[model samples]
Target: MSTQLSEDEIIQKISGNDLTIGSCASQALTYIGNKCGYDVRDFRGADSRWLFGQYTTSQKIAEAGGFVECDYNGFKIADRLLRNVEEGKEYFYTSGEHAAIIRKTGKKFEYLETQSKHIDENGFHPLTVNVLKKRFRTTKTRKLEGEKFLQKEVLIETSKISDSPNFKELLGYLNTDPKNQKREVPK
Candidate 1:
């Protein structure tokens, strides 16, 4: 039997079943992967709740040939969702403690989420809009190093120390105290 499911099939699975206990991230990832012809079980383990890290989930989606966009702007998210729909690509949106799969049908956007609280008679509600501003405005003292600098930033922003095992390790490597660092001696 073909593992790939149509959009309607996925929607029926979401609406008809009770997924109130699992992690929203895993549910969204599973829905997106299944719809796009990938097996979510391979990436997410038996207990889906344990795979709640956004960065890890994003990596899995990318590995499955899907695109991931991380941004705090709601308008940008909406625009990207529309663009992805136009291109017939599957995408997921993650913010704070919640994640959801976005779909476009005839110019209208719809969401399929596992959390019953997030869904109502009208379907999934849009995330709250919050404009994130940097608390400190300062020029960069030095350029970032490493090949995965950008990827590391995304990982840090999405992964929490409690949920993601690699979060603390990555943060420790990235966050170094300038005062404690040994400066190079001038020749």
Candidate 2:
């Protein structure tokens, strides 16, 4: 077995295309998930909670999702899973008038005044609440004592990939059927 690499180095290697879905990719993804205050098992829907993070601002959510800026923002989606890490307080998305604020350790809240893109019975847009729960799902006083929180990091890699024509080709190559292609890489 190879010695484990640091989280930042793993992320850098993954972003640089030196990593694939092999052990390197798995470890990198795990580290990335953890750094974003998410458990890989939960984000991957392996856990019973099946939660992802939630954030009000596109920026914060984008940051949490390793900055890929996909339709599913990481912060808001992970809220439900991490809601109990700090205290009973959790970030909630609603149709309100605020941009962004640090609601907890590394968690943030962003309120938008825009109309509900996703309407619910209460008249507010549908919200994802994973981070809040995963990181803070308890009113229990025990988990609240001296917990460590990570500041969220922004990932600009997606924008870089989208802007580069070569990226599409690279992604295509990476996503191609391995069975059809040669499987010469490490097992």
Best by lDDT: 1
Q: What stretches of model 1 exceed 4 Å from their correct place? A: 1-22, 32-46, 70-82, 87-90, 117-187
Q: Which candidate comes out best when scored by TM-score?
A: 1
Give a tens-digit lDDT track for model 1, residues 1-187: 2477776555444432223343445555445444545433212223333445445755543433344554444345344534545423334554333455654455555455443332332234333233111211111221347322221111111212223444333222221232232221111
| Candidate 2, 1-187: lDDT as tens digits | 2345554333332221112111222222233333334323111112211112223222433333223222133344234323422432222221111121122433443221111122221111222344233322312222226763333323322233234444233222232232332122221
TM-score, structure 2 vs. true: 0.21
Report how far off residue 5 is in candidate 1 (Å): 7.1
Q: Looking at model 2, which ten-residue stretch has the lowest summed lDDT?
A: 42-51
